[model samples]
Target chain A: MKWCTKDIILFNKEKEFVDTVVVPLVPISWDKNMTATVREGEHITILAREIEHQLMGRMVEAPPFTYLKSESMEERMKRLKLWEKNIKESGIGYIFYLTSDVDWNQKNHNMLDMIWLPAVPLEHMEGKARDAYLDETVQDILKVITESWQQFSE
Target chain B: MSNKEHDVTRRQFLNYTLTGVGGFMAAGMLMPMVRFAVDPLLQNKKTGKMVSVVSVDELTDQPQRKTFKVKKVDGWHEFEEQKIAYVFKKKNGDIMALSPICTHLGCTVNWNDPAYPNEYHCPCHGGRYTKTGINIPGTPPPAPLHVYDMKVKDGTVYLGDAHPRGGA
Candidate 1:
């Protein structure tokens, strides 16, 4: 369910059923060349929202963790691990890290499954084309999550 | 001369009293008219309104997912909302329309997913329900799927607002 009040109340009672938590990693670059990074952040947010919408009952979307682009890799990883530990302790068995940051490698992460998507500029496109692109991306993300779930169950 | 100036003219007093009473009578007469003008705006607009979805002849025992657009008014805004319902004909000549949303967490449930054949399966949390939308106990859903208010008119089926069932 969503993080909204109405859904959170229901999610609280049915927390056992929700085994997955999706945390969106948004990167913020304060430098002058922040346009591309900002665009990537927006894209990842939309992707994460669509994934949560597709798998609402099984997944709860945690508030996105915004990190500075200049932050060290070690520090970011440490923060992510702490977040993962807290989420796991709350009864979520699966944790998904969704981001458009190509620097993140899923193989390096032990506790969370990372879905890395390349940054594609969507500001130029609108209406049907943008919707179709987003839909395809959402399907791909769902497939990845479903495969992970299958592997986990097996 | 000062006392005479203080005394009011009889015709002026009569005119003042008549105008005050006339204004009251006019306001009383206009009150209902003003209410009537804005009555619809003040009333609740979300009352269940039936909208036709499909024809009776096309319905089979197997549930068919039908999407229909219904005009919904929320406060000042009015728009058409696309609603989906699983419509099927029962063995006893009864028509049933079930909402596709799972009661567990409001996820859309599909009929006969790969893992659970012949039952409505929610892809989100593996919640399953019977053909009649009754939630299978021990599953994630706490209650049964909602049933839409259904009506048939001239061989066509129409659905109204859906209500959640109390129990399985």
Candidate 2:
């Protein structure tokens, strides 16, 4: 479910059913010349949106956590941990962190499931190639999410 | 009467009459626009409009997933969205159209997961519901799967809005 008022009402009423939360970690850059970083940010946002659309009934797409490019990794990690704790306290059973930021070290954050995707320069790609690339990425993420659910059930 | 007094009275009368006529004309022009804005909001949201989903002959005892597109209005924006439902025929010959969305968390539930035969299984938190869309208590689900308002005509199945059944 999306983080909209209508969906949130349903989520609140059926909190037990809404167990999975997917958080998108996006990196923003203040540098004017960092067009690549900005493009990557847009790409990750699209990827996250696609994931949410595909698994709408199963997962709540939390508002994205965007960190500045200049921010330290330690600070971002700390913030993520806090978010994770709060989500868990709210009775969420499964939390998946989706990111296309290469600088984000998934190894350090073991508290939540992290899906790291390589940044694809989508602006350079065209037509069928871009669609195929997006479809492939979504499928990969779907596989990971399903596997995580399977593991949780067991 | 003096000429100035007579002129002043005529001007005042014209001013009052013109202002009143202008106000009435503006209200006349605005009435339909105001109604147009509020009419949709006042109309019954449940129009009971039905859209054909699948053919009755295609349905079996096993629930099958069917996807259909429907136009949805969110405030001023209107767009078509794909909706999913699980359709099946009960043993008693009644056609059942169950919304795939799990009542617990709004996740899509799959019918007849190999692990749980004859039941809808939610992959998100392992929420389960019986074939009849009744939630299995003690699980995560707080209510049963929503059942669509369904009707069959000439072997074609049509569905309206889905209503959630409180927990079993």
Candidate 3:
């Protein structure tokens, strides 16, 4: 659900049903790969919004966990783990770390599902092509989500 | 100049006419500007303009999802948003359109999911609704899915916003 007053109120009332949270990982960098970083951020952010719309009844999108690209991996992990802890304590069964970063995908996340899909340059694509690309990507991610749900239930 | 020359000075007459003409010109320029400034405020709120979505003859006993564009106004900005409505006909031959948004936590419900046959199923939390969109007892959904305000024209179906069939 969205981070709005109306949705938040509803979330509280129906917290039991909303058992999942998708945290979008956005990397911010104004240095060498600044343009690429911005593009990746846009890609991941748009995907997060679409995913929220698709599965909004079941999950809440945690506010994006944006970290600087220059920061040490150890420090970033430490910070993110804290968010995971808080969310778990509050009764979220499924925690997904959605990103377009290959580095994050390579890392070992025990409980949190690290979903990494290559960033598509949607801004450069036409409307039909963009939708076709986005729909395919969203469907792929949704397959991962539902499969995981089945595995967890089993 | 001969008959009414005593009425007023030449300077006074010119001053009155000049000021009157200048005032008219000023008002003419200001009028459009004033209207433009308040044009959005003066715009009528088109709350319920029914847009025809699909033809009436195509609807069957089974519900079919139709997509339409809704003009959404947010303060000064206005844009068209894509929306879906599920239309079907009852045994009595009357048409009904239901919004897919689940009443429980605002999730989209699907018609006849593989897991739940012949019923609307919420994939999120297992909420179930009957063919008529009534929430089953003990389900997560507390109320029935909303019905779209609908009208049937010559051969087309026009739909407005969905209104809740309120219940605890």
Q: Pick the candidate with the highest lDDT.
A: 3
After the best TM-score superposition of candidate 2, give how far the Cα of residue A95 lies from its true spot, in angstroms. 2.9
lDDT of each: 0.84, 0.82, 0.86
Best by DockQ: 3
Compute fnat per model.
Answer: 0.58, 0.50, 0.58
> What does candidate 1's lDDT look like per residue over B1-168, in tens digits?
468878888899999999999999999999999999999999875658899889999999989988776787788999765567999998898999999888877777878767788799887767899998888988888888899999999999999999987746
For model 1, name the residue pairs that clash. Answer: none
- The top-ranked prediction according to TM-score is 3
Off by over 4 Å in 3: A125-140, A150-154, B1-43, B55-59, B92-94, B152-156, B166-168
lDDT string, candidate 2, A1-154, tens digits = 7999998887787676567889988788868837867776788788888777766766789999888988888898889899999998988888998887777654466666888888888988986587668867886888788887787577
Clashes of 1: 0
- Looking at model 3, give its docking quality level: medium
- Candidate 1, position B66, lDDT: 82
Per-model TM against the reference: 0.69, 0.62, 0.75
lDDT of 3 at A49: 85
lDDT (Cα, 0-100) at A48 in candidate 3: 85
TM-score of candidate 1 relative to the true fold: 0.69
The per-residue C-alpha lDDT of model 1 at residue B13 equals 99
Query: Each candidate's iRMS in angstroms?
Result: 1.7, 3.0, 1.3
